[model samples]
Target: MNDIRVDIDPALLTHHVERLGELGELPGGGMARLQYDSSWAEAQDLVATWMREAGLRVRRDAVGNVFGRLPGTDDSRTILTGSHIDTVPEGGKYDGALGVLAGLAALRALAARDERPQISLEVVSLCEEESSRFQANFFGSRAMLGLVGQEEPRTLKDADGVTMAEAMVAVGLDPAAVATAKRDDVAAFVELHIEQGKVLESAGVDVGVVEVITGLIWEQVVVTGRQDHAGGTPMDDRLDAVQAAAEITAEITRHVAGADGAGRVTFGRWDVRPGWPSIVPGEVVLSMDLRHTDPADLRKRATEAREIAAAVAARRGVEVTFERLKDETPTRMDPWLRQALADAAAVCGATSMGLPSGAGHDSQLMGEHVPAAMLFVPSVEGRSHCKEEFTRPEDCVRGATVLATALHRLAY
Candidate 1:
């Protein structure tokens, strides 16, 4: 039984969070620190400085994944912690920032006590996870795991037509050396993040021990039909792509609702070609985002979704094509690490419940190479990726303490 007490300073956490927020402050009280941007550069430098101030050895990988290392009695294996630092456009101040700040505070608390563990501890401020720029989510995590594809740098593009390669260089990183970023010394991983949903808050729980990360399926649907003059075509005679698309979208939503958590389906983005009041739409392209915690259920839902689309297209006399944009399997947390977090939460006098993460995270990628677990704090109103997102200071402090205690137990 280890007797390490966490000495986290609330003021230090708040100060660092405020200072980091200043780098990418938007006009409307939000943050916009996209990857490889100038604001991201400044924020990275600031966090690196804090890591140094905490008496840790700090360094960056080839893809700009910053790490702070606290050496232990034996440095052969390491316990890794922390989260991403990038923010979505018009995103809130506390999404990824909280996790990184908490890691810093926890490490600093342990250092103040002059405690050493059996294994080294590291805090990583992962470079890219939001995909706000290149549609390359988990870029830093994937690079660290050697999961990045060779074509990613040349193919992915931002709204400004900037390639990932270009963005990397703009931030003083080399695209060719991405493979060198993979590390095999990590023994375990823990990430502390906001719930980003109202579950924990509504349940009156102080912390959430994540059990699984939901799997996702993204599809691009295209429906083709004959275009005709609105006045010249009768209601029954016209083969309308827009009409077919609308029917398919409605059916998809309805099926998801009836699936009993089989999965979630969303038709969030749509584009209808040749917008004109007098002309019928000839083509419709839309994006479908679906997710499920159960792999079998996810497969069933995806199959049903495609079948529904095909049925609708056939009945409406339109040609439909479904192209998969992204597909990711669900990831389960390490059982031993989960128990460690549960024990730490009890020690901190915080009630915790096991929950599933509805949103994707870098932890999903890290889990591929190392044993990983995550801690989640409640989000106010279950809101995230928006300007209105917030987490109470007390909740933040409690979560950080739990993280510190857990890390201490694991390393010591």
Candidate 2:
């Protein structure tokens, strides 16, 4: 393996991570940098300030996706890198933040080069990816690709009941200008992110070269049963919604538990009506997420889940209805770009192997329009979306260095 050094500042990157973590930091731990919220605005502004400090031309698109551009000799095409700025509520600092900061460091290092690249390089801090505020998936990337529906901004609301359009206006952005963010010149996209899984750490690898992002099926199940007083109704006589919902959840879990490694399922949200000690709930809502790398297998799992839900509801004396909140097809990284990432890792003296991403990323959506690839640094213990999520500083710099190496080959 050829040892190549790319100028990446470990201390600065770690410092930036600490600083950004403080923006939406909670009382106990983790961050809450939701999209279009004040914390998100503060975080984006801070990143913009840093971009300016790096001497790049900084601009915020209509949807609030911040871009720092280093123009190339041939400005017609651009090479894109970076990740989302938003996070899940009380999410770990490294999940999305590392990708954005790594891109910034990579671009800054590349800017100091003596020769210019053939294509421009841009680091994007996407406005939303976690969907913490609205149900709109990949808002920033969708906007960039002109895939957002016209009515989304005016229609979607947050927990505060404020429309997305209002939130945009609050941040001094015009929702009407969203169409203007559609980009056609981005030739390639390379995002640097934490693995958020145990693959790299367990295998004693430094970086993960993502091959495919899993397909997902999101189903919201609402179960209805007879409500009865806990004290008045006997256990055998009660047709409780909670019991039915619980049984349904358990059975669904059982269905996927013994299955092969090709599929996985999780029920994250459970809302019980009349949430009181004495009430036997009449309604229950559950959020089900089914994922797999193969499209056919993913669909089969989804169908099997539906059948299981129906069977469970029938047996439990409950009426169940399902609503699909989101359905995403599997996304593959560009083959050549994937090879470049692997070669870059070897050049950077970091061990890396191609792996499938269990969690979805902006790269999954970005792949639709541009040649997209991703580099993953290890998440300590594979913990993510929580305060315990972390990556060693040295590994962080190593991932960024690899990204820089890849960018040098792609752009320069």
Worst 10 residues of 1 by lDDT: 1-10
Q: What lDDT score belongs to each candidate, Candidate 1 first? A: 0.90, 0.90
Candidate 2: count of backbone clashes, pairs at least 3 residues apart or interchain = 0
lDDT of 1 by residue, 28-105 (tens): 788999998999999999999999999889999988999999998999899999999999988988898899999999
Model 2 misplaced regions, further than 4 Å: 1-4
Q: TM-score for every candidate vs. truth? A: 0.95, 0.98
Q: State candidate 1's TM-score.
A: 0.95
Predicted model with the maximum TM-score: 2
Model 2, span 95-117: residue lDDT tens: 88899999999988888777787
Candidate 1 global lDDT: 0.90
> Pairing residues by index, what is the TM-score of model 2?
0.98
The Cα error of candidate 1 at residue 369, in Å, is 2.2
